[model samples]
Target: MNIAIGCDDAAVELKNTLAKHLESLGYEYTDYSQPAEDESNLYADVAARVAYSVAEHKHERGIIICGTGIGVSIMANKVPGIRAALCHDVFSAIRARKSNGAQIITMGARVIGSELAKTILENWLQADQIDPSSLPKVQRINEIEDSILSKSE
Candidate 1:
């Protein structure tokens, strides 16, 4: 599946590591990461780009990173029809896709080591299908998002 990947300056190294891992796994991915020297690109902006790409179906999934992961996850989830999960472990990564049907996963560079990040990414990538029981929960999430968005409009 095609993937969208991005990161802020604080997580450039981790992003690079993940990019290489994606390559090794034979998955195609587009990089939206800002250059380390360019501090002008905000994490929220990066997260939005990846989230929109996935929401629009231009990519099957996305991976976004920041120093703490929280910022990007929050920003990505703000977009309509996007579920971005901040995952630091394999179980969370798997559940993010299988349970929540998350199209995007966010990671923290400072919080986890590179090897662990790769392992988490691998599990998330392999979690292609959502669990049957999670269909209702996932639908409810979509319903809630639609309701909130419609009310705002």
Candidate 2:
């Protein structure tokens, strides 16, 4: 599966480590992250790119990193059809995919170390998606999204 990855300056090192790990696992990924020295690439900018990739079906999943993960998660979820989850632990990461069918996982560089982040990433990657019985609930989420977007126009 093709994965999209991006991060801000604060998370550059962790992002790099994750990218290498993905490579070792034989996963194809697009890197939307900017260098640490590049001040122009903001978290929202990078988050939008990763979120859009999955939303457009160009990628199956994505990983985004920032100072606290919250900013990127909030920005990614703003896009229609994108379920971005901010996970700092293994359980949350598992639920992000297994329960919510999130296509993107966001992590915090300052809040979690590289090893824990790696573990979380691995667990999330291995988790199965939402169960078949949960399809109706997932559909309801989509319906709510459509209803909100429709009334806006």
lDDT against the true structure, each candidate:
0.94, 0.92
Model 2 Cα lDDT, one tens digit per residue, 39-132:
4589998998889888999999999999999999999999999999999999999988877889999999999999999899999988867977
TM-score of each: 0.95, 0.93
Off by over 4 Å in 1: 35-40
Backbone collisions counted per model: 0, 0
TM-score computed on alpha carbons, candidate 1: 0.95
Quote the lDDT for 12 in model 1: 95
Deviation from truth (RMSD, Å), model 2: 2.4
Q: What does candidate 1 score in Cα RMSD to the true structure? A: 2.3
lDDT per residue for candidate 1 within 1-153, as digits (tens), equals 999999998999999999999999999999977644654579998998889889999999999999999999999999899999999999999999999999999999999999999999999999999899999999999998899999998
* Worst lDDT 10-window in candidate 2: 32-41
Q: Which candidate number maximizes TM-score?
A: 1
